[model samples]
Target: MDADAAPRRVRADAERSTARILEAAEAVLAEDPTAPLERIADAAGLARATVHRRFSSRAALLDALAAQLAQRYVQGLAEARVDTAPPVDAMLRMTETAFALKLAHRFAVQLTASMTPEVQGGLDRLFARLREAGAITAPDPTWGRRVYLALLHEVNDLPADSPMLDGDDLAARAGLLVGTVLRALGGVWPPAR
Candidate 1:
């Protein structure tokens, strides 16, 4: 093997290990926010010393996890294609995507409440479109935005006594949350059935 190739391989391995640690951290923390670093290391198949070497401390780990979640949230917004979808559809899509991630990484999402400007702008555009399409009827734009944020928070704020939802249960709850928000905005619910 070439000498340069050896360093490249080591770096690649390190990146993989770091990704594993972050993924494990999210999963373990999802189940228990106060899980120990040793447990996180074990979940990642790494030694506790290795986890410490990588993160230094629990606070640093949380910081890294928060940053990771924020970045993932931004990426999920892009993937949801809010810019092109009709405003109402986009809102539902984005809400579902956000709720899924927020559910999977509840602690990390709690730690970081800031959104990137691009996401904020996209959301603003969606709100305007919703108003224009007569899907929402708030007198002030800010009120509409506030209502949307509140609904999003409500959906993400799962009850402490709630058990982990399966795929079907999660989809049902997300649909209910979306439907409720739409109803609040004067959109019809139950589709006139």
Candidate 2:
């Protein structure tokens, strides 16, 4: 049992390090896209060698960042429960959740502007449902998606350390973005605040 436990512990440690590296990469790269491996290692509180061992090169690190962003985007959508709620309610919730996520992962999303087909398909399905329910009248899912992303991305550019970034202010920002995008998408006027 001890022998089996040794390998499990090693695996757990590796996973933890990998997660740390990915997170550190996101923060560092967001600030300096050309930041060196040493910066990321310092941020992760690990040696540069450890990061090299986990990720062979800068490209590899960026690749991992893209994958993480894709996963996080899907998870954010799922957590918003857009499919289960009314169109306006779901849109607001999803907008708020997505804004929060994008704000947190600014660099990751920038690196992965075009998501995998699987992620895009999921978004398509959600928008289709909204259209069928008459919540939105956008003729093209891609257009609606582009408009929504543009709005969300702009919100992420807001001053991070601003005192106005409290819950109410964030919610208001999300509401504003949602209202603007929905209107642009031919969605009904006056989304629930």
Candidate 3:
């Protein structure tokens, strides 16, 4: 074997283990915010000592989860093409992306309670674009962003099997959310504002 192969394999193993722990933590914490680290370990199928070795404390693990959530949000926004898409189209895309991320990371969404600076900056730019395009007519456009985020939170709290969140229902949900936000911001309903 190459001299570097052993270390590379070990690093890959560590990364996988850490990812498993974070996924398990999100699931366990979403079900019960006060679940213990041992419970998280059980969910991850990892030994308590392994979890402890990976994250020195619960706070550290939570911090890692929050970081992962922020990274995913950034990536989702990019994939949604928020910067280049038409304002209204971008809003719909962003809503769909946020909805999925919020559902996947319920505990992190609740824990953060606010957008990370990067996410906030991206949304602020998008809202500005919306206003420039007349898709938002609110004199104070900040309310638009707030309302958009509030709608995502509401949707995120829905039961996993809700009809609104069924596999093919995502587009309809996104359209409803974007349309409501536009109207709430004084834009016309049929997206012609």
Candidate 4:
């Protein structure tokens, strides 16, 4: 075997283990935020020592999860085309993307962590554009954003097994979320697709 092969294999294994742990942590913690590391280890089908070796403490694990979530949120924003799309279209896209992310990372979202300033600023700009385009008539863009986020949170808080989260039902749930946000914020209905 090549001299470097063993080290490369070890690194790959470690990466897979870390990913598994994070995925399990998200699911386990979403159901019970106070679940112990042993519970997460069980969920991951990993030895407790392995989990401990990867994350020294629950806080460390949560910090890593938060960082991962932040990265995913940024990517979702980009995929939503928030800057370039028409205001109503952008809002709907963003809502759909956020609904999926929040549902997948319920524990992280429940942490009440704020996005990086740059990402938050981008979202603020999108809301401003929405107002400018008369898609939303909310006097305060901040209020509009809060209302939008709250709606997403409520929707994602539904039981994990809810039919709304299953397959084609996800799109329906997202549409309802967008429609409610639009109505609450005095935005154009049916979102001018």
Q: Quick one: best lDDT, which candidate?
A: 3
In order of appearance, the predictions have TM-scores of: 0.75, 0.86, 0.89, 0.82
What lDDT score belongs to each candidate, Candidate 1 first? 0.73, 0.77, 0.82, 0.80
lDDT of 4 at 189: 72
Q: Candidates sorted by TM-score, descending order?
A: 3, 2, 4, 1
Candidate 1 residue pairs in backbone clash: none
- Candidate 1, residue 146: Cα displacement in angstroms equals 3.7
Off by over 4 Å in 3: 139-141, 158-168
Residue ranges of candidate 2 with Cα displaced over 4 Å: 158-168, 191-193
Q: What are the per-residue Cα lDDT tens digits for candidate 2 across 14-87?
A: 99999999999989988998999999999999999999999999998888888877887777667766677676
TM-score of 4: 0.82
lDDT of 4 by residue, 76-119 (tens): 77878878888777777777777778778878876545366656
RMSD of each: 4.1, 3.1, 2.7, 3.5
Q: What is candidate 1's lDDT per residue for 19-102, written digit by digit as tens?
A: 889999988988899899999999999999888888989998888887787777678667766667766667777777877877
RMSD of 2: 3.1
- The positional error of residue 78 in candidate 4, measured at the CA in angstroms, is 0.7
lDDT by residue (tens digit), candidate 3, 1-193: 8999999999999999999999999999999999999999999999999999999999999889988988888887888787899988888888888778777887898767236888887887788888988887886556677788888767656665677654446676787678778888878767753
